[model samples]
Target: MNSGAKDRPSTSFSGVIRQNFATKISLCLLMALTIVVGANYGWRRGLLVVVGGLLGVALYYSSFGFTSAWRLLVFERRGAGVQAQLVMLAIAVTLFFPLLAVGEVFGQSLQGFVNPVSVTVALGAFLFGIGMQLAGGCASGTLFSVGGGDSRTLLTLFSFITGATVVTFHLPWWKTLPNLGAISLVDQFGWIVALALSLCVFTALFVLVGKFSTRETRSLVDDGPVDWLRSPWPLLWGAVALALLNATVLVLSGRPWGITGAFSKWGGHALHAVGIDLSSYPYWAEYDFGRSLLGDVPTTTSLGIILGAVASAGLLGKFNPTLRISKRGAITAIVGGLMMGYGGRLAFGCNIGALFGGIASGSLHGWLWLVCGFVGSIFGVFLRKQLGDGPYRNTQPQVEAAKP
Candidate 1:
C-alpha cells in the first residue's frame, strides 16, 4: 500500500501546533458543556450527547452519509458505501432485536419507531428523498454539514425547519389516509425470528449491490501513523460506530436516535415568537409536547452533532465557510429543505429516524422508507441535473480509498 499523507506535515510546525491546541481546547470545552447540561437533564441524556458528538466525529471523518451513498449508487453504480450501510444494519439488528423484545432496558420501557404503513409514509419518504438530494444532504447530513461550515447547508436547515413547522398545521388531514397500523417483526414472531429476517434482507442487498456495481471496490481507509485521529476513517468502521452508538441511545433514552423532530419544534417556536399560534394544531397542541420543544433529548443530540462536526472539521483543517452560492443553487436548497421538512413529518421520520432507527428496531416501516426514499432519490438526481449551477455537483472532495 502507498504511504498515507497523514504521516507528512501539511503546514509549518507553528501552524500545526496552533491547530492542535485549538482542537484540544475546543474539545475540552464542548465535553465540559455536554457534561454540565447532561447532568442537569440526567446522566443518561448527558451520555447521549457525548455519544452524539462522537457520531459527529465519525460521520465527518468518514464522509459516511446516506445522501451521497445513494446518489453514487444510482448515478455511478458504486456500491461500497451502500454495502457498508447494510453492514451497519446487520450489526444494529443483532444488538437491538433481543433488547427490544424484552421490552425494557435499565428499567425503562424500550420501544421502536414502528409507524403505520400507509400512502403518506410512501409519499413522504419519496419527497424526503428528493429533498435530500436537492438540499445536498439528509437530516443528519444537514446538521453535520452545517457544523462543518458548508454555508449552503445552513439554508437547507432553515428551510427544513420552516417546512416541517408548516406541515404540522396540516397533519390532521393527512392522518385520515388509509394505513396498515404499526407492525413490528419482534411482536409478530419473536426477536430471534426478526433478527434472522433482517439478516436475510441485509445479505440479499449486499450480494445484489456487489453483483451489479461497476466501480472498483476498495477499503474505506488507508493505514498510517496518526491516521486514526486526523485522517478520514474507514466507511465500514463509521457504519459500525454509528450503529452501536444509536443502539446506546435506545438504551439510555428508551428510544432510538431521531432527527427532524427537533427541527419542527424549533420552527414551531419561531412561528410562535411572531404571534402564530401553532398550539391550535393537533401536533403542538398535544399535552406538553410544545413546551418540550425548548430542550429535550433529540434537541440535545442534534446540537451535539453540530458541535462534534465543527471540532472534527477543524482538526482536519477543513472548516471553511463561504456566502457565495449560485442563484439556482440557493433556490434548490430552499425547495429541497421545505420538501424534506414536510415529508419527514408525514413519513414520521427522516433518514435517521425512519430508516436507521426503524430497521434497527425491526419495524417494517423502516424497510418501506428505505425503498421509497431510494426511489425518490432517483428522481432527485434527475432534477438536480436540470437545476443550473447545482452546489453539490462535484463539490465533494475526493478522498483516497485503499485496496481492499
Candidate 2:
C-alpha cells in the first residue's frame, strides 16, 4: 500500500487539493452552463439539467452499470448487479405508476415511454445487448464512462453518433415493419393493477436470479460506512437516487428519463452541418428536426450527465484520460458502438431510455426489451470469449471460494 502511495502523490491536504483540480474545474464549468441554460431556457429546463447532473454523479459514484451487470450474470452467474437493477426498477415503478395515473401534475401532462412491440424492437434490443458487451457499456454507460475520461469510450461514442445517424436513412424501411404499436400497462389495466403486476415481475426475477448465485460476492451494493464526499457510494444508494431522479425528470419534463434520443438529435445536427439534408427523411421530419440544437430537454439533460460525470470523476481523483487502446479493442468498440446506436434507435431507446424508463413507465415493450436483450447478452458473452477479452475468455466456471 505504501509503495502504491509512493507511485502517486501523497494524500496530504495539498495533495488532496492537487488531486481535485479537475473537480473544481468541472464544477465551475457546470455552474456556468447551468446559469446559461437557466437564462436562455426556462428555469424548469435548467432544473432538469441539474437532475441530469445528479444522475451522472450517482451513476459514477456507484459505478452502477447496466452492461457489466448483464455480462456478469450471463458469464459468471453473479446476479447481484442484476438484483440491484430490480431494486431500482421496483422503486421507479412505485413512483411512476401513481404519477402517470394522475396524468397531470403541476400543470404538466405526464406520459410513459410506451412503444410498439414490434419485430424491429426485438431485433434492435438483441443487437443493443450485444453492442453493450462488445463496447463495454450501454447508452448511459457510454456517456458517463466517456465523461469520466475513458478515452476508448470516446471512440465508441463517436461511432454511436455515426451509427444513429446512418440508421435515419433506413428508418422508412423499418417503420414499414410489423409493429404491434405501443402498449401501456397503466392504460390497459388501472395504475393499481399495473403497479402490482410490475412489482410481482420484479419480485419473481429477483428470486429466480438469486438462486443462481451460490456464493456471496461484492456488488454495487456495499455494507459499510461510505464517505459521500469522495468514496464510492453504496450501490443501493445509487439505485434509490437514480429512481428518485428519474421520477423528478418525469415531473419536470412530463416524461420519464431518456438518453439516446439526444444522441440521434446530435447526430442529425452533425450531419446537417456537413451539408447533408436529413429533413427529407420521414423520421427527422416527424420530430421537426429543424429546431435549434440543444433546444430540447433530452439534449440538455444528456449534456448535464456528461459534465456531472466529469465532476464525479474529478472528485474521486480518477479523471485520467488516455487514448491508449489496443487495435482489437478499438475495432470492437467501434463496431459495438455502431450496433448500440442503430439498435437503440430501432428499439425506440437503449437500456436507460427503453428498459429502465420503459418499464418504470409501465410499458410492455420494456419487458420485451429485457428478455430479448438478456438473450442477446448471453450470445455477446460467448462472442467476447471468442475475441479473447478477459476472464470470460480464460476462466472456467467455478464459484468464488469463501474468503477466510
Candidate 3:
C-alpha cells in the first residue's frame, strides 16, 4: 500500500471489507449473468458481449471520451482531443470503407449506419450536443461512467431512456421533415475515392486545429510493458483503438456501433412490463417491435459495457460510488439525459451513433450531425454557465501528462 494509506481514515477495516465483498459479489453476478445469457442465446451474441466489455475497458483506461474533447475545444480552444478524434475518424474511414466495399470480414457481412440528410438530423444533433454538456456525458460517456461507479450517471441513463421512449410516439411527425434518405460516399463513389475524400477532410481539420492550438496536451499513456492494462492511455493510441473497435463492430454486427437506440428499446420494454402497449407506435412497427423488445445485439452490448466498466474501475481501485449530489446537479442530469434521448432519436444517433459512426461510414448526415451538434454544444456551454457548472468552471487547472 502507499505510505498515505494509513492517513486516509475512509479506508477503515469495515469500509474496506464491505467494499471488497460488494465488488467480489458484483463481479460474480456479472460473470454468471453473461454466461447464462450467452448460453441461452448463441456464440455470436456472446462474442458481441465480449466486444462490448472490451470496448468499455478500452474507453475507461484510455479516457478517450468525445464529450470532454468537444467541451475542451469549444471552451478552452484545446484541440488535442479534437485532433485525436480526427485521427480516429481518418483511420476508421480508411479501414471501414475498404472493408465495407469487400462486403465481408472473414465471411461476416458488413454495413454502415447511413441515415438521411434531413432537417431533423440538424436539429436533433444540436439538441443532443446541448444535452451532453448539461448531462456531463454523451451516450458512450454515460454508459462508461455508470460502469466506473458514478451514481449520477444512473439518473442520466434513466432520463435518457425516458426521453427516447417519448420520441417513439412522435417519430412519425419528426420523420416527415424533409430528408434525402440514406446516402453513402462509398455507394456514390468507389471506396478508394471515398477514402481519399474522407482523408482530405481529416487533413484539413488537422491543419486548422494545429494552427490554432497553443499547447499540445500530452496524454496520460505510459509506454511501460504493462501499460495496456493501465488507466489514462495516450490519446492517439486510444483513438486508434476506438477506430478499430468500431470497425470490428461494423464487420461483426453488419452495422456501426450505436448506443441510444438500444436505450430507447429498453425504455419501451420497461413501459411494456408495466402493462403499456407500444405496438401501436409507428417506430416500433417499422422494426420487429415485440421481438426486439427482448434483448438484441445492441442491448446486450450495452449491458456488457456497464459490467466491463465496473470491472475496469474495480481493478484500478477507482470504483467509488456515492449518492451524494446537489439537487440542482440531479435535475440537470435528468434534463440533460432527456434531451440526449430525444435528440438522438430525431438525429438517428447520438455522438457515438451519428457523429462518430456516421461520419466514419462516409454518410453526409454524419457531417451534418457534427456541425449541428457543435452548434448545440455552444448553447449548452452557455446554459451550463448560467444554470450550473460549466466545463471551464473547474477549480483545478488541467496539467498535461508527460509525453511518452
Candidate 4:
C-alpha cells in the first residue's frame, strides 16, 4: 500500500520463492540459528575467533576425508583407508594448536572441549556404528535419508529414537566414562611442537600410502572417481557432507553433534512431565553416564528432519507407502534401537558425537570406536544376511529405493 512498495517490482520478492542453492544456503543459516538458540557451548572458547575459524575449516576437511575412509577400510583401494583420514586429521589438529595459543591472547584462557579416551566411550560408539551399518544409515544419514524419502531409514529412525529412550530409562545404570575435567589438546603438549610433529608424521604417511597404494575399482562411495556434484550422487557424498556439517556443528555449537542423547532426553523428559513417572529414571541414575540418556535435544530439529524428508520425497515425486522387512525385522529394529539408545547413553555420543566427532577432534577414542565398530560390522553384516533381507519392504523401488 505504500509508495515505496509501488516503486519496486514484486519480482524481487517473488524471486526469493524460487528454489535453488540460495534456499539451501538459507536453510543452513536457519540451522545455524538453531545453534544460537539451543547450544550450550557458549563463546567461552570463542575468544580466539580467527584461529577458531581456521581450526573449524581444518575440522571440516578432516571429517570430509572421513567420508571415504570407511569404504576404503572395508574395501582396500590405494591405501585410502586411514591415510586420508589421518592426513586430514593431522592437518586439522595441527592447525587447531594456533587457535589454542591465540585463544589465550586475550589473557582469558578458554577451556578446550574434548573428551578423553575411555573403553566405555569407545565400545558404545562402536555399537552405534554397527547400528548404522546394520540399519543402512547413520544418525545424520537417517535424518537426511528419512527426509529424502527412505522408508527403511524412517523405520530405522523410529527404532533409533525408541532405543535411545529405552537407554534413558536406565541411564543411571549405564554411565562409565570419567568426565575428566574438560581437557584441551594444546594443554597436554606444546601447541607448536604438537602441530609440527603431527604434520610431519601424517604427511609422511600420506606419501607412503599413495606410493605403495593399489588403486582399486570404485566402491559405492564416489571417491573412486566420478563427478557426483551435478546430479544427486550416491550416499557417499551425503556421508561426507554430514561429516563436514558435524565439524561446523562443533565450531558453532561447542559440543559435538549427537542425536541419541537428544532423543533420549526428550523421551525421558516427556515421560517425567506426563505424570507418568517411570521408576527407571531414578534407578538408572546410578550408572556412570545414566543422566539425560533419554530426553535432551530439541524435537523441532527431528521433526524438521522427518517432515523435510517427506516433503523432499513428495516434491521429487518419490514418496510412497511401504514398510520395512517383516515382523522379525521390526522386532530387530526395536531391540537394536534399544541397544543403540542405551549404548549411546552409556557413551557420551552415538555415531555423530563420538565416532565422527571424536575423529574430527583428533581424539584417540574415535579410532577405537571405528575399529570396534568394524568388528561389530562383521556381526551386523552377518545378521543382515541371516535376516535374509527381512524388512526393507519397498513400495516403489524404481522410484525411491536407497542403497543399503
Q: List TM-scores for all candidates, in order.
A: 0.90, 0.92, 0.89, 0.62
Give the per-residue lDDT digits (tens) of candidate 3, residues 316-354: 556667787778789889999999999999999998889
Give a tens-digit lDDT track for model 2, residues 166-214. Answer: 8878988998899888999999999999999989989999999899875
Model 1 per-residue lDDT at 135: 86
The best-first sequence of candidates by TM-score reads: 2, 1, 3, 4
For candidate 3, what is the TM-score?
Answer: 0.89
lDDT of each: 0.81, 0.82, 0.79, 0.49
Which candidate tops lDDT? 2
C-alpha root-mean-square deviation, each candidate? 4.0, 3.5, 4.0, 10.3
Candidate 2 at residue 225, lDDT? 78
Candidate 1 residue lDDT tens string, 124-196: 9999999998887999989888877777889999999999888988888999999999999999989998889
Q: Return the TM-score for candidate 1, rounded to 2 decimals.
A: 0.90
Q: Which residue pairs in candidate 1 have backbone atoms (N, alpha carbon, C) closer than 3 angstroms, thus clashing?
A: none
For candidate 4, the lDDT comes to 0.49
Candidate with the larger TM-score of 1 and 2: 2
Per-residue lDDT, model 2, residue 387, is 90
lDDT of 4 at 322: 49
Deviating ranges (above 4 Å) for candidate 3: 1-30, 220-226, 286-294, 393-404
Better of 1 and 3 by TM-score: 1
